[model samples]
Target: MSDSTKQVTEHEVINYLKEHPEFFINNPGLLQQLTIGNPQGDVVSLADRKMLQLQTKNQQLAKQMKQLIANAQRSEGLMDRLFQLLTDLSMNAPKGEFVSALVGFIQKDFASDYFKLYLGDIKLSDDEVCVHYHSAQLKTLFASFNNNDAPLAGRLPAVKLKALFGDESAAQSAIVLPIGAKAAHGLLAFGSKDDQKFHPDHASDVLQKLAQILAVFFDSQAVNDGQQSQS
Candidate 1:
């Protein structure tokens, strides 16, 4: 009848079992002291009692493995499309055709409902695609991004949505990938009518790589234009 010997806490018992996994095997008499209640309400062997815990642990590990595999597969698919996009952009063609092809390839491969490619001063044959903006205006609109070059996804305010899309833009959510404020002074936006299409967690490193490639194209085209003017 002492306070210290009243009872052992559940934490101590669990810790003891974890630290000494062979305790039950070493003392067979201890197994008779442990019992787990099942739906059938009958006693099970110690092995049967531990089976449920082991099965639960296995299921958790399996779930984690499945998630990892899914992520890897998604990344692989993006890389393949990116390679195709790069190959398309590398072909020898007129500047107008090059930009048009770049936009077309992205629209086809990325499954975007609506998209806007904003370049500083480029003129497109299609007036609908002539979504150009000054670098200062872009810096202001995307100031929320903290000047980082990563792609952003999720809902945008009505003003930012209108600025990126159009006045009658029907996009409920979108993904914005910054090309370069200094070099290209451009951005690529993918919009979707479905709010869940570009949910907050849809960030992809592939889009950042795509943005970098676009910056290179813009810089190279600038150089090409300069050469043509001199010749």
Candidate 2:
């Protein structure tokens, strides 16, 4: 072929490839045709194939990410419904039934298998009902803290909670939340077993609000209980 007729560079071959819509990459014979005209054609064709493959892979990954996001959104919606149900139950339920509902809701939603709502003592040692809730598997975990122990004094980190509770233990994770002001009567221990389910930093703004509402509800319950006692 004449010097002018010969393909000189990979860029020129790439341009030629752009112009050729009929080229189908099926066999070694076609590949050879592309590479023989100029060695640059082989490099250009390989580079083109790599770029195309990367783009296709990225598109697939994007689809998977979208699906994951959608699934997460649905899960969050379900959780919202459950929280709303708990609030409704607390408001309309009979006094004893309301407390049972709150406990059952935590056990079901948090998947702790066992948990307790303790009132009148934020200091853990001051109360045994709360401790017994985790009695089957974690009695020793609280040996270090007592009612005399100040709040936040011996708090366990998320990782430590998981280790002590056992990854598979039905009540493996616990969160100690002091509701209301220091004068408030109680602390709530929210526990669960799934390691990835509850983190120390998990968002609980909604739960905090729920606790606030529960504090009010319990306060009202206490007055009624006192009235009955006097009667």
Candidate 3:
């Protein structure tokens, strides 16, 4: 017989035993007598070897499916918790807490690790927005840009904001969203350690809604501030 016809390896033998355990399972007489105890005869056959491999593959596939299901359920639960937290922040939090909640929303809801919240002077003549708040983590990561040097200092090209933010490999991606009651009054920027998180093609509805809410809140706050200043 050719080399291919030779007896298989020990790993194949063990694998065969696992596949069709029924082969020996039903025949207790042969199962007990065919082991190393009676290794004189042909212990395991080629058919048994193939069956074992198939069984092993099937078991592995089942394990993978189980893991996938568990992960899906976990993700769903996390989303539910996140939604609840955001709802509470929006409806019941104080004005000072709004910026913190906004940054938290970007980080937790969208998986962004770095973000900025710019609150423009509604009373200013130009469309000027300044970084009034930002994530503490982002402050640490890019300390140089936190203060007056924040992206708010320079006028940026709307078309190229993505390229500018994504250049530093570490900055990953960014977004510039306008916040205002009627027109845009502020901007929200998000960056990531993973470069793909904030691509220009990423969806904007969620962020847009966030900007709108913030604009309304800020405008209201500005009115309150003016009243207090006159008082």
Candidate 4:
């Protein structure tokens, strides 16, 4: 017989084993009888290697499960707060009333050190929380968002902090959510004293959801205002 005919390829063995998964149970002695070589040049019985592989896989799965649990627990409180905020804002509120309610929630439930909101050109005077929408600054800072309702989270330098909040000592870390569809309606910025409070890696689905709703709310109002003006 030729060498090729005599040789039992690994693929054939794998296919055979897969086709008959009960092969191991039927030939139990092969578990100890067969030996495989590892990359470390160690020869271990098939049974030992299988057990080691299973243990490693189990450890990896356990670690993944723990991380999933941690993320879920962290999001639970934020979800509750977001739900409450939505409930409060659903009272056919005017823009000024909406801003007040949101600022209150941010200070109390969201634990933000400082927060600012900028909507379209309105009659209200400029303040820390409600500011005139400087289109140029927003365009510069959030060019990456491409003028969409996306949230930006990370630490900001003194230069950026000074430009946005008019105070270099405004915040160490911050989250900014752009509120708009195509043209920007405005933005909401939350600042924190803690340097590690906000980060790019931190998943903030709740805030993104709120920003989308705010964009829709503002767009609908603008449409209604235009209709009333025409009438």
TM-score of each: 0.61, 0.41, 0.40, 0.59
The alpha-carbon root-mean-square deviation between model 1 and the true structure, to one decimal in Å, is: 5.6
| Residue pairs that clash (backbone atoms under 3 angstroms), model 4 | none
Q: Return the clash pairs for model 2, or none.
A: 125-146, 125-147
Q: Which clashing pairs does model 3 show? A: 179-185
Deviating ranges (above 4 Å) for candidate 2: 1-94, 112-114, 121-173, 192-197, 223-231
lDDT of each: 0.74, 0.54, 0.56, 0.73
1-231 in candidate 4: lDDT tens per residue?
Answer: 998689898999999999999998998987899999999999999989999999999999999899888778867876787677878675356876665666566566555776777666444644534455646777676666674445778887776666666665558888888777543777777778888988988666766776676787777778878998999
Better of 2 and 4 by TM-score: 4
Worst 10 residues of 2 by lDDT: 130-139
Per-residue alpha-carbon lDDT of candidate 2 for residues 123-224, written as tens digits (9 for 90 to 100) = 334323433222322323443334332223123565545534445546544555544554154555666655454565554554565467667676776677
Q: How many clashing residue pairs are found in candidate 2?
A: 2
Please give the lDDT score at residue 26 for candidate 2.
35
- Cα lDDT of model 1 by residue, 148-221, tens digit: 65677888787887877778878989988877753345788888888888877885676677677777777777
**How does model 2 fare in lDDT?**
0.54
Q: How many residue pairs clash in each candidate?
A: 0, 2, 1, 0
Give the Å shift of residue 39 in candidate 3: 52
Scored against the true structure, residue 108 in model 4 reaches a CA lDDT of: 62
RMSD of each: 5.6, 11.6, 13.8, 7.1
**Better candidate by lDDT, 1 or 3:** 1
List the candidate numbers ranked by TM-score, top first: 1, 4, 2, 3
Best by TM-score: 1
